[model samples]
Target: MVSIIGHHLINKEEGYQILLYLDPQLIEVADEFDESFQNKEDLRQVVNSYVKNRLPDLKVTVIRVVLGSLVIASIPLLPGTEIKDLDSSQELNLKTEVKEVFENTPQEIEKDLLLVNKNNSLADNYTPLNLIVPEVPFIFKGFHEKKLMAAKAATALEELFAAAKANNIELYAVSGYRSYQRQEVIFKSQVEKHGLLQANQISARPGESEHQTGLAMDVTSPQVKFKLVQEFGVTKEGQWLKEHAAGFGFIIRYPEGKDAVTGYQYEPWHIRYVGQEIAQKIASQDLTLEEYLA
Candidate 1:
């Protein structure tokens, strides 16, 4: 009874060879045919078709085995084929490709997260918080009259105020830090007054609020006589923030059109402290924190 078997091989250039065997030599059907296969799978496919055609009149078994660089080169039947290894060598040559694609990828990649860290790491879904709250020179509402801020945030804010005063922007610091109990009152107020939705919009849950860290602040224009309207962003201070907040480690969190991504409406007042390195990256990439993190 005539039988045929086909096998695959790779790395032949390094003194490696692909031998076709049949228990008993089933002479080369023709000569060693020279065929070019774009990939290992293609080579295996050609081998299977070659074997089945020759053994149409008999029951035969086809076994696929890898030789050299074809590390995981076997796919028995054509039932559930998977390309899991998928260009391992190609990926090895460019492992950092994903990072390059999302230099400022947002933490809100999933459409409801505000990015907060260098890795676009989020304060919402991430692990334990590393809040470094600065000492209070004295408990006061607006920034000290001395014009000094805390440190990273303080220095950045100084510049922000300096820039604003230069152009007569009239920036005003509305609020900052709150203790755990204070946050509880805010959250409870939200749950008591309107509902979870509106509450979440105005106040973050006790542990999640940036105010607990004392690093975040709400800023406004002292000259804008409009009692902090929903349209307050239309004021000159608002316009300035839209254009320049990113320069001083501040991002207009929940920007005008990114309400969905931030899980809140456009909050022209809520600003987060992500530091200059992070802010610049976010600005240059034009990505929300969620996008960067994701």
Candidate 2:
């Protein structure tokens, strides 16, 4: 019962071809091999021991082994191939790959890098600590709740609005820091008016909205009549934000052509604060929050 087993390192056809031309009698002895063997080196030692005692005339190189029903082999490392050795310093850094850290965990929500979407929802009670009302111009006066944002985010928003004002671009803060209850109301209203499918593209279910994070804000301009509409994206204030928001640690979260990934329409009015470093990185790459975190 001759058999061939391919190592993961070698191409399947190449490994089988190498075994095909070996002596038939030698191939038959592979069935007698112990199941404990792991790779070529282990099989080589076992075969050498068995052949020396039982059949001195037959010389063979055990290129493969099968432990129970599992086949195993080892191919020599080729030039330029990376080896993962625990003792090596480089291998330590490889342990912290972003996918390994954030995949299958809800801890990202507690951190500033939380990814909230239709698939990843926040808890109904979740609210960012240190929420404060940013000192910036708004479409209306005395809407304190709507002007609120996380402390760091509020500071960044203030700076962002100040910069725009200096450049003669008058921006108006329309909405920010929406509570879970407010989102529920908004979502229900959207559903009632536009149907569920269309509502999902425009408004998020209570816990799924980024507005609940206190790290997101909706901005508009007088040119758009201070309304949260698509035309706001084309306004001079919106264009300035698209160009410079990242400098102040903000990003246009739901960007154009990324509705499929974000599960929302292009909301040029929506900006999210993710710290200067990550904000700039996401902006430079022209990536959505989902792609950046992923």
Candidate 3:
């Protein structure tokens, strides 16, 4: 019959499980896992093949356990360690034990996020932003203040452009992941154009910027020069993006009236990729990333 003794690997909820059976005589197993197969060992090679084809990442095992007179086929649950030379417990002892391995898995991983710090990693960045990039017609170059973007930004941007076209929205990446030096140049240009007073209202200092992370974008419709000014957001396409961008794992970096904490002015054109779930929380609560993090 069908058994549940195997890894229950899934896109959203993946982990380990076990399932097996026993017979009355228990002297001999009617079937033994091909070692090449899994919980569905009763069928044939096709069973293992099916799971392998569908889940290239899962490692399956079909084993036989003795239950007094009957021998049953089962897949036993175990820790995340290798199953080879298993010596922790005897065969009959495993029948009544259960361990919550996946439940024990940590919710977040520590990473080295050099942009935020030399160490910033999330073991589980469960932010659900549906922001997948699609194919694009062409690529365009952008500048913030007056500096070039990173290669990663250019690549990710091409995907955004493609997604915009397929979704029937006019979108473009005006500026993308930039560097400290580039940001310094941009900060200088803004100081020149808007003067120091107005410049702080727009441009950002080098180390204090998110664009350096290669996961943000300054965008607009093709009609605009990728500007962070007014008219861009009022456009139909801009308005649409403002309403639905978070669904795609993106967030409007700085919106109206949060400049006090953002350390800058409201910029409708700036979008950051913080994954979908995290971005949604940031958007729904009227919180900037800086505020949310704080």
Q: Which structure among the candidates has the greatest TM-score?
A: 2
Q: Candidate 3: which stretches are off by over 4 Å? A: 1-160
After the best TM-score superposition of candidate 1, give how far the Cα of residue 149 lies from its true spot, in angstroms. 7.3
Going through the candidates in the order shown, the clash numbers are 14, 0, 32
Residues 62-165 of candidate 3 have per-residue lDDT tens digits of 33332332233334434342334233241322232222233322111111111231111111111112223323332354323323333433444565556667
Give me the candidate number with maximum lDDT.
Answer: 2
lDDT of each: 0.47, 0.65, 0.48
Model 2: per-residue Cα lDDT over 1-294, one tens digit each: 222211111223222101111122343444443444234343444333322332233222222222222233322222333222111221100111122211333323335676777755554556677899999988888856778999999999999999999999999898989888888899999999999999988999887888888999999998988888888888888889999999999999999999898999999999999888998999999899878866
Model 1 per-residue lDDT tens digits across residues 88-159: 231111011121221232222211233332111222212223333333222245453222223566556667
Identify the superior model by TM-score, candidate 1 or candidate 2: 2
Q: What is the lDDT of candidate 1?
A: 0.47
Ranking by TM-score: 2, 1, 3
Off by over 4 Å in 2: 1-107
The estimated TM-scores of all candidates read 0.50, 0.65, 0.49
